[model samples]
Target: MPQLDISPWPMVILSMIAALFYFIQLKLLNFTFYNTPLSKPMKTQKHKTTWELKWTKIYLPLSMSQ
Candidate 1:
């Protein structure tokens, strides 16, 4: 076999590191969001992820402040 090509190893390592960081960030966000004292917990995961909610949160503040 030809000498193992080491060129791709860096990318593989970087991808693994990126995945690790993403999961870490997700876990932190989940704990912070879900444990909040809301009267009614979110009915669905999409309730927060939907673009409309995110847009409204971002838009309302700017409109009100202006």
Candidate 2:
């Protein structure tokens, strides 16, 4: 049986940690760009349609009954 060489795993882990810190520093620390002035939303009036004004009973097919 041949043994696996794990020499490059340490460098790979270090690179991953460095990438995580880089991402956090660039994205998490730079959160002020998302801050903007808030504006009041426009009030919308609800209108009742013809179908909504009327109520109807719905029946399932007889074959669908348990």
Candidate 3:
């Protein structure tokens, strides 16, 4: 096989653009909602358990360990 070479400029430019967009969004949200509190307290949604949580807990690393 002939030697193959690849350039990473495209990936670098894409990631930089994505990061810039994220920062701009964060700045916009901060400016619009800096002092406003939610009118109502946020409620946590309850999920029905169907063995998924049990399996994940058994296999996944615990936060305390990390």
Error of 3 at 45 (Å): 55
Estimate, for each residue in 7-38, the C-alpha lDDT of model 3 and write its tens digit.
Answer: 78789999999999999999998885467766
Across residues 1-66, which tens digit of lDDT does each residue of candidate 2 receive? 999999999999999999999999999786876768799898999999987999977889899976
Candidate 2 off by > 4 Å:
33-66
The Cα local distance difference test for each model comes to 0.78, 0.91, 0.80
**TM-scores for the candidates:** 0.45, 0.45, 0.39
Sliding window of 10 residues with minimal summed lDDT for model 1:
54-63
Return the TM-score for candidate 1, rounded to 2 decimals: 0.45
- The Cα error of candidate 3 at residue 33, in Å, is 7.7
The TM-score, computed over Cα atoms with residue i paired to residue i, of candidate 2 is: 0.45
Range of the 10 consecutive residues with the lowest summed lDDT in candidate 3:
52-61
Off by over 4 Å in 1: 33-66
For candidate 1, lDDT tens digit of each residue in 1-66?
779889999999999999999999989987845566668765765445576555453356654756
